[model samples]
Target: MQRSAAISLTCLISTAVLIKSSPPEVGFTLANSVQIMALSPGDPNSYSRPDLAVVTHTNLKLSVDFDAKILRGWATLYVKKCGITDELILDHKGLNISSILNDADDTALQYVLGEAVEYGEKLSIKLPQSESSNNTYKIRIHYETSPNASALQWLQPEQTAGGDYPFLFSQCQAIHARSMVPCQDTPSVKSTYSAEIKAPANLTVLMSALREEVIESDGATNTYKFNQPVPIPIYLLAIAVGKLESRQVGPRTHVWAEAEFIEQSAYEFAETETMLKTAEDICGPYVWGIYDLLILPPSFPFGGMENPCLTFVTPTVLAGDRSLAGVVAHEISHSWTGNLVTNANFEHFWLNEGFTMFVERKIDGRMFGDKFRDFSAIAGLNSLKEAIATIGENNQLTNLVPSLIGVNPDDAFSVVPYEKGHTFLYYIEHLLGGPQVFEPFLKSYLDKFKYKSIVTSTWKEYLYEYFHDKVEVLNTIDWETWLYKPGMPPAIPAYDNALIETCKHLTKQWLQWDENTSCPFNKSDITNLTSNQRIEFLDELLLADEILSQKKLETLNEKYDFDTIKNCEIRFRWLRLCLKGRWRAKVTPALTFVTELGRMKYVRPIFRDVYAWEEVRQQAIDTFLANKDKMMYVSAYTVAKDLHLDING
Candidate 1:
């Protein structure tokens, strides 16, 4: 029942022959290998010239020198000429290049390292003229990553929990991969890779790939090898080395963290197998052979990076109640949505994030309930509206397909693509009658675009083509406003109000808590509600616009005591509300709380608000200056931008 590559070729060739008498078509055909002429336009943010030659695979051998704070490595890239001349350009940032050689002939190759730009320096390698379009060559470059490599965060032994050895990890998304490894540094180009990492024997190494038992350290150092059979985008490339260990939490899933955190890490992510199974039963089989979770240090930037096999997650998700496991579900959902089918460019990033959000909620719905899904969606809806307003409704970044040309991709990162994209898909499901009616289209969409990157145009085309005669339903969609217009979508998808109505009622009561003499909601009331309900209540209060009034904050905090909340999500928001409300007492604890965890989801917004408090501006500055080193590059870069501080090492 599966359509193999050969059948695909035959079908395309047959169609082409049939259309030959009519007109010249725009595509090509079948054989032992089908030539992919229509590669995704690729990321504009990258310095690499992928149009000239495409990288097929990469081999990385690096040694982590903790004392020197560097990763010295040589990268071997195998590239194929795309019916072009003999020159290849790669993206490199702050890398010390020693030499370049032709792997085919083992001879020196002439190269040029261009001036550094916003993304990186362009490394151009001259190669022998191509014998044909299929001509392939290997270029090996000897290099060492700069100490200030943005993607890599090197931590001293004292900086980590173990305090016995140094820690190093990579956050390569959004063009940072170029700083660590020279390549296209774009999500559009996926290359299967193998990594041989040498590190201190006292540490364990893990990457976004399969791993085997490491022989006990021989002496001062140990070597770890990883192989990713599936081709993955550069952004998905990741690695971590520290006093790490793992424990099997599911049939096909494992959790990795430092020895002290391993047990709790396993418990938090124990439902990964269930999530994977539910997702497969909903969409299709999970393609990635094994699913594993790795808990990075508190400052691991984002909530989770959905690296193909190994997902890098933040330590904040370990709330002891598993209330934050939704993040794990989100990452697992990416295995199907992002890893399998990627967005061709950051301009149309919603295809990756949006679909993942949709599938993630679907899996969560099955695991918990429809109420849970709608509740989460409602919270996300608030965030989307806030993001749009924050960016200014007229800003193009609020669009489903934002323009990334001549702009850094990182600046456009927001919840618009995520929530808006989900809204669009949910709208389509409604148009087609329901999810059941639209289920096949979802599966087929994944099947058609599996292991490939695509732009919005391709997605729209395939969607229309799938519906065939019934494509008329799509005609109802205002594609232009929904896809291009700033602000919000033309229409809002209907959410089950049943779940949020109670949460909304409680929020309203709290908003008037200062005016009311008696309140039905007490500390027991807080305990009675779900963790997500607590989040919803706090999120609603943030919109009261009367946050500057300390009277209300004192009354609320006195009764509920949000300062001691265990749920990180609720606790962070409450602390933020205190700052926004000018609750002077909150400034100290807020400073302390921000230092405790560096998860952007919790800390970035706190810094942004506290920085604006004016009263505690210097306090905020001093705290960030003190702890910025503890933050990940992505989070630190963002905070620095918010505070207009230079990126400090």
Candidate 2:
């Protein structure tokens, strides 16, 4: 006779309260003899017990309800029972769960929604004893996302470029996926997923998967099907709904955006296919069949998110000259470094970002000589310096592997991982010969860890194993200081200074010039510099001991037309310089720039600079308050902390 398992609803609810009150070190046992740990060993931001039971595949049937600003859906999860556990624990933040049912028999199952915590809440479900010996079972959860889900950003028609239809997109990096769907919301768990999303007939829906087909529409809504065969962490799950159009840029790539941006986006990313091919030549193979780009609205926060098969980018990168296309290369590199071999948790984020940064520059070097690659590395070092100063020299967050036990991963985000991580790998490459020797190890590393999530220790073990002959050389380096110590790396790489010297010379000339001296610079001074070089010039000026005088700034702007530049990178640095120089006339323009687009790279610094100016501090706070609702959740949250505002408020 088959044994049945049933849990009392009241008892489960009381258990949830007890779990909430317990400390992080506590563990609770369920009625079905499974233990729910406070946090996963590899992922402190989640409450899922993947060691016991993990989701292997997910099938989502969600409908976009723009009126309600929510996603009503049912997620059917195929779970693999890893241990002798009869209960499954998932992560959820704010979801209205209606019912839980066994897929095979359609029998109601008992579950409990735990009290909320810093990351989210624990969702414990009792599993029925299996009659067969199979270790996998199907479980279905019926729920609706909260209107104010942190993973989702709902925009009105006015917020979009077309001003004709509303828009919706998701940013689930770190630990926000729990707000979208209940699952093993941690990078420690990788699962393939298929989705059937329904949206208004007038709008198009897209996901981080290959588009299969569109079912017949009923004039009001259309159902779109997508399948992602490559297993991915829940954080990479993405969706965008809007009035979008697409242009085929290459045999394997398409650029999607609103009608206003379609032509330019297609032109801007026309070399995407080339980048993909170059990446393949370096990183083995591009397992993701199709590579596409989605240009989100101005309010999109990051430079780009490397969702497998589809990349979500910001409009700020459309500089028209393709100078900013390096962001595209970075995302493509993630197709192998991040999307293929995953970081087990946010704590080891450098494994994802640092590896991608290293590969991105390699791709750049392959296209534009080694000097250009070294030039980019120098720029990245400057960014790392700025990040360290902002985060504090002694702060643990500056470490490559930060302790995020009680901290939100979002708060710990910075360039430390990207640059510092790259520095470590670059140092290793120098020690073990150059790219000639390191390139093979790169391929080997990806091949061994493909389709799996791993921690830093695992990666270190593999690295040492790969370079066994050089164990003596590796031991000579200090691992503890590099990985755990705060502040910048101990040593900087010998970057080629050929490209940066020109920018530095121009910066010095401007810095030494006096207000009384005849404006020594002319238009020809910067005419020969590339867009990236111009940005480097501006960055050097910002790091000076004193801000340039207002007169000098005006003269500089006059010669270079910095005030009217379209490239976001140059414009961001120029705006910060103006504010630092106390150029009152540019304050309004600076506010306009911060409000216009929500990319945190530009927004956070501009806002902080303005706030630093005591005269405009209140004004900056007011601007952020009025426009915070329009910013992405991560952007708003980080900017709030930057301004010292109460996050809850």
Candidate 3:
């Protein structure tokens, strides 16, 4: 679940330490004397009572209705009663439940739908007395999702690349899963799932699982069956149906996209196998069997969603040069950090994002070099600063483990967790020995907590236990400031500036250029720079004390031809610079970029910059109003907040 907006800002640092002997391989079992608690202390955002009874498995039978833009079907949940409770609780939003049947006997079950709250409505169903001797029970819920399900983004034919068939995709991370399924919508509870989805015969259907078989029910529709043997949080439960085609990219990988972008996607993600192998070398064996990629439409919000076997990626990454493929590495690393070892709740989100960022850079370093890894970390640090400034330095949301009670996790999403978490891990790596010492601990940690959800405290305790010999050095770290403090990190690691120095020098030259001085820059000045280096140079300019003048920007575009660049990352930074300088010519280009793709990372900031310019504020609002219906729920919701526009209107 890597956010595309923060992809460019990812950072990493590595070091080495001396050890007395080889670190012993730890087993999956925890010590009985440690008194481990439940997966979480009850997620505040969920209404489910996992403490009493929890769903262990979910079997879905749903039919897609593109005309009505809804999914009507039944979910049969296999539950395990943990306490002497007479009811089963689940989380649901905008779903109409028709009936609840006790699968043991063909009898109806009484249920209550609680009032809607900030998160969602609480669904409580009276449990039928079990006739079996075991504690497990099966309850079937027949329901239909609303046309406006926040988790689903229903696209018309015009919104898709092919413009021949409609598309449907789901984004259920954080808490939106409840809108689509009747289950405990929290990462603390994981369940194995199998789905039978019926959609138009012409459209292809895919989920976050291995495809068993597809049956042609009739000439009009087909039933796509998928089975996920691995138990995963409901958030990882994904489904997409559209005019899709697949091309075999690797032994266990396939790149799925529309006919228009299929070839480009296959080429862009050709290194997915290399990334998976590199991640395995750094972390551990890949638990999920297959690692396929689904190149989603431009309206896909995030950079990538690590949905178990199938990773959902934004079309913005098809930069033709494959320079942006590192995002796949981030999602691949999540196979262990996030999907394998889950975050107990959104408060401990850093455990998922920060660890993934650390591992992603490890893959980068292994694939490229240590210097490139450090350069990425430096870029991440700049992004962290920008995030803190955007979300006020003193705001508690900037904390690594901020209290998410009553706060929408969507609103709290930022680079703090991704970059700050990576910074903390890197700091610890430097303090202890380097990768030689810490990398072993990472594998051990994954082995200890794989397939389980945990909090920050559990991770910290394990960290202390792993490096018992370095407890004295660990004691020197200020846990309070690092975990709870809001602003910049307490200390920045000594990153190798050998690579970024060139970007800095170029940035300085551009900042110092003026009408009094002859144009000192040319296209050759940047010809040797990598795509990431050019991005770093642009990032530095954005953070400068004063925005570059329009004349200088014109010179930049003329010299570098940034206006014609196909790379989204470079285009994003260039547009922001132009908008900040109040270059009216780029305003239409910026608007087109925002409307064409719904990646929040690029859209939100550009919209904010446009809104800041009084002359275009109304124009920005109008453009958003016209396109809000096409944007993903999270993207539209957050962008509306940035524009101060009423979403209902």
Per-prediction backbone clash count = 0, 0, 9
**On a 0 to 1 TM-score scale, where does candidate 3 land against the true structure?**
0.93
Q: 286 in model 1: Cα distance from truth in Å? A: 1.4
Instruction: Provide the TM-score for each candidate, comma-separated.
Output: 0.91, 0.94, 0.93
* Comparison by TM-score, 1 against 2, better one: 2
lDDT per residue (tens digit) for residues 1-649 in model 2: 0011101211222232223221332232352112224666546677887777778788999999998999998999887666667889999999999999998889988898887876789999988665645577789999999998999999999999999899999999989999999988877677788999999998899999989999867989999999998888899999999999999999989899999999999989999988888899899989889999999999999999999888999999999999999999999999998888887778789999999999999999999999999999999999999999988999988999887666789999999999999998888898889999999999999998887777787788898999999999889878999998899998887888999999999999998988796877788999899999999999999988877889999999998999889999999999999998999998989999989998988999999999999998999999999999899999999999989998574
Tens-digit lDDT track of model 1 for 23-112: 112332342012111111345566565555678778888889887888897999877665355787788899898988887767788888
User: How close to the true structure is residue 367 of candidate 3, measured as C-alpha lDDT?
Assistant: 92
All candidates: CA RMSD in angstroms?
6.6, 5.9, 8.4
Model 3: per-residue Cα lDDT over 201-241, one tens digit each:
99999999999999999899999999987778889999999
Ranking by lDDT: 2, 3, 1
- Tell how far residue 249 is off in model 3, in angstroms: 0.9
Error of 3 at 641 (Å): 1.2
Output the worst ten-in-a-row residue range by lDDT, candidate 3: 11-20
49, model 3: CA deviation in Å?
A: 0.9
**Which has the greatest lDDT?**
2
Q: Which stretches of candidate 2 lie over 4 Å from their true place?
A: 1-37
